[model samples]
Target: MTSSPAVTAPAERVRPLELFFDLVFVFTITQVAGVLTAAPTVDGLGRTVALLAIIWWMYGGYAWLTNALDLARPGPRLLLLTGMAAYFVMSLAVPRFFDEGPFGLILGLAYLAVVLVHTAGFIGTSGHRGISRLGPLNIVSALIVVAAGIVPPQARTWVLLGAVALEALSPVIAGIGGFAIGAGHFVERHGLALIILLGESIIAVGTVASELGDVLRVVVGSVLALVVSAGVWWVYFEREERDSERLLDAMPPQRRGRAALLSFGYAYLAMITGVTMAAVGMKKAVTYFTTPLHDFELWLLPLGLALYLAGLAAFHRALAPVWEWTRLVAAVAVLLCVPAGLLAGGWLMLLVAGLVLAGVVVVSRTPGLNET
Candidate 1:
């Protein structure tokens, strides 16, 4: 009697390495927050955006790699875990890199080392099928980052930005590869990451509110932050994710793969950019009265709100065929509230946040929007 080979499932069981990978991101988040806290300027904000963009690409790439490769094997799992450890070390060095001049090169080298290790493992375990698909873009991006490290200090920023651009472009190239991309898990991980970022925003709000000590300010700010966070949650998860799941499940595998790549890998850049900046905005809102709103702080609030709104709109557009009028209106309302919030002080900012939340709740409850 001849026996058939055991078929491994495409969606592998979540492993300890995946969990450890997530822990490294916690440090990544902290490093980013620390950088924002120290610099807190317009240049600082730009730097933070560039840095987060690069880190998000790194995280997203590895995530897709894990989704594609079977990590149940000891060799693959150990290599990935080691890469994650290297990533954690790189994350730890971010604050120092930004603060101390001499340490920047050390930090850059450390970060490159992590990327090299991960890239090598990704290529090795991905097999011919997967490697042939994403290999070229991966190789291109890895080289750019490595080359960026060799540039002089004055020229490093532009080089780093170029490296980041290369990394961001990898998904577009990878999507051209016709493979069974797991849409469900991809969306799930990003959704969870969004929640984690929002949670950080809430923590920032609470901490800042506690420092205020005034009952009225604390109460007002706390409520505003909660409402804003709730509005964000309502906007994304209300029906968008469900719709995406249905759409992908119904479509052909190749098109579904492209859609999943576009939605989770590309679209999420806007969402995370907004969410991280919103954390900065919340910090500014809490401290606006004591510290005069600098040009950067002034810009952060509106920019963050705009990015968040844009991301929501993009997600809705992708999920539903018909335009979401309510979402468009909500986005406009949020943008309009920023200047008014500036004029009325921190409490007013909180009030504006509440209004935005109310809009999301109303739209979420509107007829014909319910998931099947």
Candidate 2:
């Protein structure tokens, strides 16, 4: 009898290449947060989203590639390292791109080059079957990127926007086969990235509080921000991770591929969106407290909270059909507290943060919370 190829479990050990790739994402995250910080207006908000979407798509594509191929292989490892270097260049260009008129065009072109190199590497390493699967979409993406480069200055922005959309949709249209990378690795990497985002928020909050020179307020605000971050951590890592692993494992191979794509691949967009908004909100809160509440900052506070809560909701919904009442209540309470924070000033931000933590605690401890 012929022997079957060995099957690997979704919980198989993570490779070093995976970890190194994640380290590179740290720079991408930092660049994203910095861009938001530089220009925190409505127009800036749209640009930030486009930039982030492009970055996320690039990272997500490579992640899926590693999921299928053996990252320990020299070819894949080198490609990832090269992509990492390209991403760093893109990140460095972000600040200048946003600030200078001509620089934005240059940044856009640099970003396209990074995507092309990464995609080309994938195509080169991918064999006949893999190439056949990815070829058309890859061609389309490359064309879009090239087109973005040559577009008129007035139209360059929209061209780049369209390129982002094309890049984002490539995977779905490609229908590439799943590689079955360990769910644990996927979850852990994202968990670590989320921690980095929260860490950034804490750093931002601390900086703001210190500038105020009010010891009690700084201590309270810092503590509250920590609690908020903890709540976000608990909500994800506490039970959701295990449940998702179980669900993915129980699914048939074909269905599991789709599940992985939807869960790990797409859902992260919502999660990152929340983190970005929260970061902005926290910064505004600190500024509003130090000075008088500007109309814009007042709007930002609630809007940021809403985005964060919406992401939380998206995560739960994607994992399973069941919903926790405490999560619902917590989200609503956070929203309600937004106005109170505005009226009472910075203390209200702290108070809303407290409510968010309490809701997390309640949800985490709730009896008989059904697991998918």
State which candidate has the highest TM-score: 1
Q: After superposition, how far is residue 206 of candidate 1 from its true place, in Å?
A: 2.3
lDDT of 1 by residue, 1-372 (tens): 965433344453345567668767756875786677677787677667767777777787676667666776887778787778767777876776544355566556656666666556544332335556565666566566545555665455577688677766665656445344566666666676777677777887788888878676587677777777787777778777677767766777656655655666666777778777777777777777433454566666556766876776666556555566666666667765467555765556656766875777775778866222
Q: Which pairs of residues collide in candidate 1?
A: none
Query: What is candidate 1's CA lDDT for residue 332?
Result: 69
lDDT of 2 by residue, 1-372 (tens): 975433333435456776666666766666776766666767666666766776776676666555545565687677767777767766776665544355555555556666666555544333324445655565566466445545554454466578677766766777756345456666666666677677777787788878878776588766766676677667777877777777666677667666666666566776676677666667666656533355454555455555555565556666667655555556566765456655676557756766775667675777775232
Candidate 2 C-alpha error for residue 179, in Å = 4.0
